[model samples]
Target: MLQPRDELPSVLYSAAQVRDLDARLIAAGTAGFELMQRAAQAAWRALRRRWPQSTRVDVLAGSGNNAGDGYLLAALAQKAGWTVRVLAVGDPQRLAGDARLAFEAAQAAGVAVLPWAARTSLQGVLVDALLGTGLSGEVHSPYREAIEAINASRLPVLALDVPSGLCADSGRVLGCAVRAELTVTFIGLKLGLFSGDGPTLVGDLVFDDLRADPAILAGVPVKARRLTAAGLQALPPRQRDAHKGDFGRLLVIGGDSGTGGAALLAAQSALRCGAGLVSAATREVHVGAFLARCPELMVRGLASANQVLPLVEAADVLVVGPGLGQSAWGRSLLSVAASRSDKRQVWDADALNLLAAGVVQAPAGLVLTPHPGEAARLLGCSGAQVQADRPQAALSLAQKFAACVVLKGAGSLIATPEGELALCDHGHPAMAGAGLGDVLAGIIGALLAQGMSAQAAAHLAVWLHARAGERLGSQGRGIAASDLIAPVRELLEEHSPCLD
Candidate 1:
């Protein structure tokens, strides 16, 4: 539910990638310590801008280059006539090279350097440089206590680079992580800063490239890209003489009994998103309700799987599994839909559950949208494990099924079988409601029906859905799945006008 900010770089690097980039920058004539000084300078300027009234600074320093940045910041603060304190969580004696030089600089500036203890009192705008992107294991010892104490203090904090104990690659917290009010990141933007627990804990994020040579950066492989307006491919402008048949037919299959609402949301979303022909195939029990709710839909009620074949045959894209119960009725329709391998498909809800249960093989030309739990079931692992490294889990699922996978939640991620990955950091907390997935599936199906490839459709749909939720979420709670349709339609038109 974090707010979306101005556009950042599309490419996101792993911690290893950032480290390599740093090394290359140093080897390419930028001294390592000089880069460290620039990082401190960037952080100092950001801190001053964010809290100009606060004149005191407390820097929690650890060993390694992370601490080097902290020590340098403490030096800068002291020189600026601010009361500065450096709580050394890791032994400063262990510091070497640039880190040692930074510590000496801090001492020369008369910054109060103290060995951290459980009872140490923190003041002013706290700086978390105790741990950086290199931390992959659980936080241990004094660092864990230090992080806990920082969180307990509830003081405004500015974290240098990645927050202490936050996995820079996955956005997962290692045991405990510092909750900073502002984070100043150096070099390339880390994928973790926008995904998982990152948005919640990192607070306001500010990125500085540290003036790394663009050519040196281009040589490093990017792990993923953030979804942005400029990067989105718009739907082709409608011709002066247009017909509904010009788009594509999209069939929404689901809504067993009491869950007909879910399927209705999907159908409604597709209709709003400009599908040529939108149809809903559900149990006979829900047919009247579906038609009543969305009169534009071509609604058909069925008692068995035999009734779905004709609809599946006509659809250019199929959105399956919204409100699809695990009963025989749901399975029968899913089986029939699964058989239509040539039709582009978007599978969600029970469809994903059924696929995980081995009841139906995934179809060709497919997009699977699953939340963390559903993704875990699809990958044969626990939800926690999947969430631990969402990027890898998403990639694994895509490779296993040879389909485009949209792993939805906090920072929704889209991955393809070819190992391409993209992340969407646009959304709001009010979006935490039921039937949203169904709406999302329909949006994707509508995009596919409009002739977009699965990857492109997913990227656009995910971004649009999240952005719509974000806009509506600003009004505060009570956001229904149906509520997102109009906004989504409006957003689509804005992104791609009908005439031009």
Candidate 2:
């Protein structure tokens, strides 16, 4: 059985792993049918709690364990005096094993099992039990029709375990999927529920372990860990004897020509994130505006990479890319940064492009923050391909570059060379604006300079940056990168801090 938050496991599992656990539990003495029954009861309880006044339920059933849970739930509703109808999309006779047993139980309970029609007048709460985590390909036929009907009906839906047609391994929607108002999942938390299309499809999520044995879960491996402020250990408070150089110096290298704002955003974020000192090595043309906007930042106008060597040597960490172009000047500066093995580096935007062009080698302890397109360039694949499997893509980048990789998209995945992966479930659609990645790069660089490990700083910085975007997303679109500084600062204090 799943425990409370305090007792819950830190790891999350895939759908296949959950199924394997079910098989193990059955082999270990617990009946498979009984587990299916428990799952149905959990879903039923959640449904009733969500809509206590509603006495009607329309359950769309498929031919699998997922549908078995729906049949059992319909039976429970029927027994409880609720008007329940089981719209069987797949042939109920084809149900095998525990699923067939559940179907028989529903029939014995007098639940009306009817064939679904295009005009099925579904009212009250909609229960989606069409497909489970077993889905491998796109949804087909009557099941697709049922999902469309459920979505078109404008009725509130409660998905059992996971929303039908949603790939539990990745949050990708298969052909068509049910968008439920609430999804009650079982056994262990699914990584898909927090990434890719998962957030949009699985409304308010609720997990029910279905009474699986704790020892059974120990055998399965987790794909990733969800990042939360609670998981972060507090940084030791700074002593009263701390001085200016006690923190770290961060150098921002970018701001090619017209896009000086990108470099400025990164520099500002570094300063706000607690870098002891901040400097910008940008195009000579943008120097005036850079200093005027952030006079506190040590601005240096540079025409060549040679001018940046001295600043890079003085800095504890380097944040390169941002508005950097693929021009000769940008390449020179990137080469200079790449040559220095002692300083930590954060590569974003054009810097990532340079690396992808094989213009420079990524040093160890480098953090690569690339949006979907940039990541695609690094992997030599299309952006769509990268977004399709963010976790795998991020891990591949980490392994290839031997650096911490942050693949930015709907469900941003952070992967380290050690095989550790973390997913940030926070952030909002409003963060769809430009320059946010540049800001994120600076945040990570600052954290690294402040003495945090490369991996931890990447995870912490991405989470804080995304969460800040989510906080401001409610204010509507056109969220400027500069707007995130204050909220990110507050979030940093709430998570990690060197001072009280």
* Model 2 poorest ten-residue lDDT run: 1-10
Per-model RMSD to reference = 1.6, 2.3
TM-score of each predicted structure versus truth: 0.98, 0.95
> What lDDT score goes with residue 176 in model 2?
89
Question: Looking at candidate 1, what is the lDDT of residue 295?
Answer: 84
- Candidate 1 lDDT, 1-500, residue by residue in tens: 11236555788999999999999998999999999999999999999999989999999999989999999999999999999999999999999999999999999999999999999999999999998887879999989999999999989999999999999999998999999999999899999998889999999988889998999999999999999988999999999998999999999999988999999999999999999999999878888887777788999998888888989998899999999899999999898888878899999999999999999999665899999999999999999999889999999999999999999999999999999999999999999999899999999999999999999999999999999999999999999889999999999999989986
How does each model score on lDDT? 0.93, 0.88
Give a tens-digit lDDT track for model 2, residues 1-500. 22233243457778888788888888989898999999999989888878888999999999999999999999999999999999999899899999999999999999999988888799889999899888899999988888999999999999988888888888878888899988988888887777677889998877878877788878878778887777754545778898769879999999998989999999999999888899999988999998888899999989988899899989999999999899999999999999998989999999999999999988887899988899999999998888777788899999999999998877788899888898887788888888888889999988888889888888888889988998999898889888999999998887766567
Winner by lDDT: 1
At residue 465, candidate 2 shows an lDDT of 91
TM-score, candidate number 1 = 0.98
Q: Please tell me which predicted candidate would have the highest TM-score against the true structure.
A: 1
lDDT of 1 at 364: 61
The backbone clash count of each candidate, in order, is: 2, 0
